[model samples]
Target chain A: MAVLERSYKRYAGALSPEWSRFLIIPRHAFRDVFRSKLFTGLYALSFMAPLVFAILIYLRHNTEALAIMKLSVVNVLPIDATFFLTFVEIQGWVGFFLALLVGPQQVARDLTNNGLPLYLCRPFSRSEYVVGKMSIVILLLSSITWVPGLILFGLQSYLEGWSWFSQNIPIASAIFLGSLVWILLLALLTQTISAWVKWRLAASAGLIGLFFIPSVFAAILNQMLATRWGNLLSLGSLIRSVWAGLFGTFVQQAGQVQRMRGGVIVETAMVEPPLWASWLILFLICALCLWLLSRKVKAYEVVK
Target chain B: MTLDAPATSSHLNDSPGVITLDNLSVTFGGRPILKSLNGDLRGRAIGLLGPNGAGKTTLIHTLLGFHQPSAGTARILGSDIRGEANQIKSLIGYMPERDSFISKMSCIHFVRFMAELSGLPPGAALERAHEALFFVGLGEARYRNVDTFSLGMKQLAKLAQAIVHGPRLIFLDEPTNGLDPPARSRMIKMIREIRDSGQANIVLSSHLLRDVEECCEEIVILKDGRLVVYCNLEEERKANKKFLMLETRGDLKSFVEGIGSLGCECAMTSDHRLKIILQDGTEIRDLYKLAAASQVQIRRLTYKRDSLEDIFLKAMENGSN
Candidate 1:
């Protein structure tokens, strides 16, 4: 019998460069995130802080509006280092919640369904898969955190003029670097937890517990050991320390941190760990998450 | 069923098979799965026939660079499996036995995603995804979510993603699994079309002999992790001595004598069933004329050739010995 002629033709076009292949994972991930109305709402809400901060910068610089409102800059909100610090801190925390919403479902579903083989069977390696999944969280967190934080910083600099911008250049740098560190930590931690825990809800809960559970244990250690070294276990304390260090406000903000926790106004005996220790601890944690991710993401699981 | 001599050559460098194994062995926790398997297969559509636990999937995985060999190595398309894994994967497509798709995606989206992962540009990937879905008979439901597809549809979607990149070699592990008769027939037809297109070489692994028999040009039968038979179906058919079965309602002794005189081997296993091996000069027409002359009624006549099942059963028997 004569063979049936197929209309299908081979693809003769050039492939995209190899480096751009990993972008496919994040591209689809962004689409999936935006597909959900709730995720879209949360993502939009994350920009609110930067938007409000931008408006505040505008109001502080516009003397006519301030005069119309009959409010002085000091009487309203003083736009200074602490103001931008608070801005970045708020944005970073919002990024954390965003990670909790989207991170657990990113790689967990793929791992649970044994879909790594599909990815690895192509031209992609295991490291590419990990970086691809990480990009989803990195892009999500970046949109709300450093990206807008820097935009607001630019707005503040534009409104306040070059003299003020030059004097406070370090503050802008702090906002960018501080928010970047926060998002990186959150992205790695959430992705690692998600990769290990197959269920989305359990992985989400595990990510939350990873941040909070250590603080409780750290508190017990602090009470027993009479040292602030235990605070190293608390992600909140470590991040705050890192943030303060980035802004060069740790010495001035330590008392406020203690007071905000409702501790007595007297001098506390617990000496906070050095800033280097905080940075070291965060780096180690990031490394550990990467190791765990590498262990879990593979084409096939060999069972002995 | 006659068994051919075992493939005793360590490696066949003279003939470059589509895939070559040189003492390839794999183990899990010191327990061997595939033990020093060596063969060269050049069939356009090769069938991997094995029972459960016969290491069919493992062999496919090894060839795809999923499993690192414990001892020797394998080369696919002149590229070593270990070092050139990404290079090899870029040129090949794989459809695993189990459910291995991202279900949350639409069929076209998933196929496009897979094609992009195989290194096609996004635009070309999208176009090829549509073409592959239509080729696999899933164009109508291309917009449907993959998770919502029926078992047969899901299988076709798997096939679509596998071929979306226009790969040079495609590995299909149980491609017709879990389908009804019509779906199975459609799958076999698709496989035949793919084979006929000359666009890619297909390695179809199946436990069902009919599926392999219908689509494969050559076969490799494995039993207990050993290569029991590696023979081309075309050669096997040509090598077969023609046999004929006759059911007559008259004296069989005279019929056997008549057939023997015609230079054919004749045997009578029962009163009414006669088996005859035809010689080169003898034909069925001559037998009918002989039967008419001998006053015998020819009720049935069947011509037989060697089948994949016969080779598989013979390979199993030889492996046990």
Candidate 2:
């Protein structure tokens, strides 16, 4: 009987990060980003918004021609650059909301059930986990910002004719690259703030403050100080100024060929204080946020 | 079903006979949870049972290399906690008490993912996942999305992920917890199968003694970060029931006077009927011949086995206060 008792017994669980731990975040984020109704809706809006603006521009341009010629229907319309700029501006604005949604949930979900402890029991350390999360945020931002932006850029170029594509490719790419930097900074800042705080809502709100509040304060300081650098210090002003700088450069050089009817486009030329400075500021912000994030990382066993 | 070849590994028998503590302790949030707990642990299945606020999770965390102990050492599986966490952890399969699986993935995918993380090759990982899920008896349901799974299914999925890697040891924090009776039994059977295998060892901790009693060969009890009861179910089961039941072919009454001298007490009901409460060192033949030398009718006799509950309570009584 004693031997039988001993024979029937068993013991078993050891969790290590060396195995399936990384799969948890990536797989969940993939499913959440690709399969959820929320992401689908957001993704559709992101892609379709550009087309909608293009269509509206086409209708506006050709409507008068169709009316004057008394044609029953119009098959073609010119692409308007104004609609494209508006799309770019709206893209930056919408990114803020996207950052708000993505940042908080990542940390808050872990905190809710003491999930950190269970996961810590695995082979991964807190740093690796944080890195994994940051990787997901970067991927999410890339999908939203660059992917759709590139498609829209291509679509617009095709509609504008091969002449415009050949002439404006360099200028268009530089401006797009600048926009990507902006998106990268926005995503990193928001995600870092999210990791630093426990509550999802509070983290989201905190990210908003981290992203915009300092810029808002800087704007007010610019008014009082009346210095270009003061305005440059504000993140919003920096983004606006940098993008405007890139656009202004495009206008001065590329517009020479496009031949703008309005007074010589001077705003693009005004974005002066060197392109490297804007990049440096963005780099600084990203580094700061990551440092703060490293501080807030709590090591414990996280489940799930 | 025994190895004629003696086990060669020093890990299996040379040590782990007694758990030795060298001023091991842990603190959390400016408060000490385990205050320099020092002791030796030797037994089969150990249950680190404690109340909710007693820092059971914290201690397990330290053991799993999650938390650095504020002071001292937690030696398990042949090395101090931190020094051999990798070696020790490679041998362990952990089942957490809650539903922590990736919610949207299919069960098979989730288990397979963990298996790969445990260093299994892709083909072997998927195969093991299927076998593990089948072992846990979740077969066809393995392909179902975990988000849609019921809580119990999710729990089982977590368990499946833990065992898919074929770890050498396992730390189950309430495996049967929150499970229905049937689900609990199914889980118990799976644990038993894993335990009986010679490939691994297990140190499962749970507050539920019933579950501990179900499959554990030994139980090491803990309370308030201190050792409370180390109930060896195998030893305890042998200690109770039919105390000193004797059979003889001669006069057992003639042996009545010699029973106490043999270091055991006796109960004489009739001339030939004898019941002896054998002491710690009493020979089986001493009683047999005592009756055989004279004349006593040989009858049926055996010592009854003790239930785990009874032994557990006694151990608990002895350990506490």
lDDT for each residue of candidate 2 in B139-228, tens digit (9 for 90 to 100): 779888877887778778878877777766677788887889899888888777777665555666777767887777776555566555
TM-score of each: 0.88, 0.67
What's the CA error at residue A122 for candidate 2, in Å? 1.9
DockQ of each: 0.36, 0.13
TM-score evaluated only on chain B, model 1? 0.86
Question: What Cα-based lDDT does every candidate model obtain?
Answer: 0.85, 0.63
Candidate 2 residue lDDT tens string, A25-100 = 6555666666668766775677566667656444544667567767543444334334344556677777667666
Top TM-score model: 1
> Candidate 1, which CAPRI tier?
acceptable
lDDT per residue as tens, model 1, A139-228:
888888878877887888888789988998898889888988988898888889988998999999998898899999999997776567
